[model samples]
Target: MRLDERIVPYLHMAGLYHLVRLNETWFRSDESLVSAFMERWRPETHMFHMPFGKCTITLQDMAYQLGLPIDGNYVSGCLMDFERYIKGGHPAWMRFEELLGVLPLANCIDKFTVKCSWMQETFGKLPHGVNDATVKRYARAYTMMLLGTQLFGDKFGTCLHIR
Candidate 1:
């Protein structure tokens, strides 16, 4: 199999690769629908108060829509460790440099943020005969890109928090 094909197992293991295909046609945003939803959203009740009745989207709904595995516990990272990644001073940066083979310039890094486009352009393609460690790193870069472009996408949507 090709080297690019190797990353499939890693992404599949993480339950993310399938989401990439959704972007081909299934993924789309409707501003008017979003506005309508927002208009009826009740944060206090955590439900949508419609003229008919109040209802809420369950985890199952999200799982069904996004093809995410709902069986696993909610995964989250510690923000406290973010300070250690600043300015390439910490060992985490060293590990990143080792995996990616290059660090973004100091000017390009905004606190814990880096341009997702820069990351995609930099590590998007893996070198031939790369070791498992290198392939894992590429998988991680793709994961970050997927997250930044899909679920947690912000208005600007240009950069992602690297921490």
Candidate 2:
């Protein structure tokens, strides 16, 4: 299999695990394992989004703060990965479930399964053929979901929020 093909399953599993953690369940048991997996799979680049209140930071504005060219391409790659996985289908889901099982979180199994259901539904509506537009939309949605979930978790005092 191609590298992309091999990685797709891992990505799907990671995505599902992420979704479960974001759903307000504390994966206390699997914390270390999850952390290790995240450290391995997460992008090396730093990502920051402006909070909803009392913050002013645009992607363009952040450039001055970082003193580096803030390329939007990093976000683009995230979305592209999602698109590629969706197009690849079953092997991706299988890999994702397998990875989810590696974590010691008990409740996570069901939560991750549900996340896969949501992803499948959302992906089914997209254009079968991949294109820049579809990828961008997927990326934007993914980013927004992350932001909203984090904010929600903070207000509710749940462990679901991204750290």
Candidate 3:
């Protein structure tokens, strides 16, 4: 199947209506909003929205499209990995914590840290050439966008930098 066909459906599935609407409002080009969202959203979480529903298009699906099995749980695993990555003194974690517009939940942070450590130890194998710093920033920005989308929806306009 075509890449766009595969992804557009997922965007629709992931309940990213706001994101799609944002693309229409902000960027008046025929560009791939899904690609932009993936690049800007949580790059670590290998999931995107379907073009028509609230289901997610996972990296496993993409891998399957490339003739592999959808056997890995990389996306969900990454969430925990991220918690550890943050606990490990990733500068971007500080930035993200600030950007979320909420004071760090001290108790939650501690708990999350332990969970993240377990995830890292379990699925911690690194991908080749994955720069830690770049991943950190991207994860932060993606997280910001995800939260911002939830908080503001389409009501806040361009007050948040989505691009």
Best by lDDT: 1
TM-score of 3: 0.21
Candidate 2, overall lDDT? Answer: 0.37
lDDT of 2 by residue, 121-155 (tens): 45324344666554444543343344444322222
Best candidate per TM-score, number? 1
TM-score of every prediction relative to native: 0.66, 0.24, 0.21
lDDT of each: 0.73, 0.37, 0.38
Better of 1 and 2 by lDDT: 1
For model 1, the local distance difference test gives: 0.73
> Tens-digit lDDT track for model 1 on 1-163?
1226778898888878887765637567675776687788887999999999999999899889888888857656666676554556566556667666678877667766778768877777878898998888887777777777677654566787765
All models, RMSD in angstroms: 5.1, 15.9, 15.7
Report clash pairs, candidate 1: none
Evaluated against the true structure, the overall lDDT of model 3 is 0.38
